[model samples]
Target: MPATVTKTWKLFIGGAFPRTESGRTIKAVAGGTVHHLCKASRKDLRDAVESARAAQVKWAASTAYLRGQVLHRLAEMMQARHGEFVDAIRATARITPRKARDEVDAAIEHVVCFAGWTDKIAIVLGSQNPVAGPFYTFSGIEPTGVVAVLAPDASPLLGALALACPALAAGNAVVLVASERHPIPALVLAEAFATSDLPGGVCNVLTGDHGELAPAMAGHRDIDAIVAAASGKRATALKEGVAENMKRVQVVDPDSDFTDARWRSPAVFRGVTECKTVWMPAMA
Candidate 1:
């Protein structure tokens, strides 16, 4: 009989998997198996922020049509690994197989939904403004740069995808903090991101205690905004920490159904994007 090889999950940063600088590990039980996962530290968070910042510039520079293509590729990658995601969710979330499959299906569908929005956002959110002068004025949307995402403990895959797709679709880079309790699903999903056509550093995943990372993320000067599936003190900590820099912060109920149609609304992109208005002299 051959011995089965176990895999140790590492932090996904800059489109690569690496161990934590702190050399810390947390144990998680899934599918009657114990696995070791890298426990991210403040330093890890800083690295992710740096990576995201660098990538956001190029990602935002890409044409909206190109960005949409990248997002669709990501969805295809997720679909390729559908069964693995379903199993991970079932193991860690302790949900029935059918429910787990449904979550994975919804997550993939949401990614495709957001992909369609990338190209349409300008048409839907931008506008030509009427000014009382001989000038042409218009307002357009731009990415907010690096965004930090805090995923809920339950529905790890769906929650993370739902919150992150909006930011990515808006052309912003993301640093995602996976569920502290059940991170297997998020880590598994990271594999798909690595293989997808999406550029490196566009999406990074960290597995650790949210309490430790949320405050650090809030105070991160480079991070332009945050969208968290959290509430109570955790949410409050983020609000208070970002006061100094006035960084944008949004909180969603962790318990909310990520598959809801509201999550797919174009309004979700507002927080992740900045609206800019420009005026130019009109040619007669």
Candidate 2:
């Protein structure tokens, strides 16, 4: 038997692994094998978005409890594949086995944490109040619809899944741009999602050229929000670029601890609808 892995998996899109429409491949070392590039194009992005949109209405309307269950199922799937996730991370990101497993575990934990938030949002963030008038008014949260995420290169699995968990938990469909450094985890996560009973486009992952596709995302009217984990000039550029769609941006501290207590709160989450009300009356 061979000691080194000779083959790796393909990009998951529309519930399948497809060759690039461009019929092109980039040569890269994945799992100790010469891996072929799985090129994704603008059309693929649209297709993925369409699937996500189709799933949106039902997913958005789904009770927070059901959404949470779906996420917990996803976490279970991920936990079952924990070793494989670690192996893929170790191979692609070039991290120690312990480090790889930690990140993978952190991702799972993030999903489960967010899952708990689904039903608890009302208790934590919503409120019932006297309208100060004859009628009564109440406040609640809502999903922001489709959100596109640009996964950070440093901690591929963590950042991608971190943003994904909240993005989806809040009932928003998500599209993640896989990190250039480690695309394998995104694929594996995509596979886990495939088994999670999520809507087809509810969580889409693509591995491709960021520069080329980012502009399209920045200006996309369909996308309600966008998040990117980056440094230096790239961060600045993305902030300005997303202006066309007015997508919300959430910048994270790169050096922060993964298991920080602050992450448990809903205020820390981004990419959701927050309704503010104002009441004014003039008395004679």
Candidate 3:
């Protein structure tokens, strides 16, 4: 071997990979192999939020059926690149190939499941309400604009997918912060997404320290909500950061079994969605 070149992973923002504006790099070591990943700063977080905000409206405007198709296409892309995901998870997570394969399989399954829900969510989340007067009232679900997802340190691929798929299913733009310790899998998934039908900026991945970015995500004025897997003091800090704007915060157990049946529930989308009640003339 003449020379060894290490690749510095870039942040996925607005459907493109860009080096962090802060120009900081963090190293992740796995089995004597070192990987360089972008260290996203507060400024990077702001930029991700801006991209998400810009994409949210158009994404939300797409027909539910189209959104469902796009999501399913993402699943197909993941399946196509299944081996890459398995290897990434295995290397960073230090798991057996079989276990890594399982995680990748689960992640693909999770994406397909959420793809089905994109169209069905309205049926589960919306309702026709009884009105007192000669008016028809309906409650419909709407995307919560831009959402920030903080992936759990463990099960990097599955954990990130579990949080992100729901928000995407509900037609919200996402700003995903991959696991600090093992972010390669998330970035790998980002590559699959890049080739999929997902609109640019619809799902952005930032690789960096959650401790540094979570508070920034919580306090960001443009981010409408946060879905994170954290506990104890880490969880508390995230919650406290939302005091100013009161952004919707949903903190799940970091050790949550992502394979749990509850992940499929329409209720899972509630945190990242809003209910809009419309009243119209009965004749119309």
The whole-model C-alpha lDDT of candidate 3 against the native structure comes to: 0.90
In model 2, the clashing pairs are 52-201
Clashing residue pairs found in predicted model 1: none
In terms of lDDT, the poorest run of 10 residues in model 2 is: 275-284
What's the TM-score of each model vs. the native? 0.98, 0.87, 0.96
In the order shown, what is each candidate's alpha-carbon RMSD? 1.1, 3.6, 1.6
lDDT per residue as tens, model 1, 1-284: 99998877999999989999999999888768988899899999999999888898899999988988888898999999999998888766768889998989899999999889998898999999999899999999998889999999778999999899999998999999998788888998899899988898999999998989999988888888999987999899898857858788999998898877989998899889999999999976
Task: Mark the 10 consecutive residues where model 1 has the least summed lDDT.
Answer: 239-248
Report the C-alpha lDDT of model 3 over 1-284, residue by residue, as the tens digit: 68977556899999999999999999878668877889999999999889889999999999989999999999999999899888788767768899889988999999999989988888988999998898999999999989999999789999999999999999999999998888999999889889999999999999998888987887787888999998888788888857858789999998899888898888799899999999999986
lDDT of each: 0.90, 0.74, 0.90
Q: Give the per-residue Cα lDDT of candidate 2 at 94.
A: 65
Give the distance in Å from residue 276's predicted Cα in candidate 3 to where it truly belongs.
0.4
- Native-referenced Cα lDDT, model 2: 0.74
Best by TM-score: 1
Q: What is the lDDT of residue 182 in candidate 2?
A: 74
- Pairwise TM-score winner, candidates 1 and 3: 1
Order of candidates by TM-score, top first? 1, 3, 2
Clashes of 1: 0
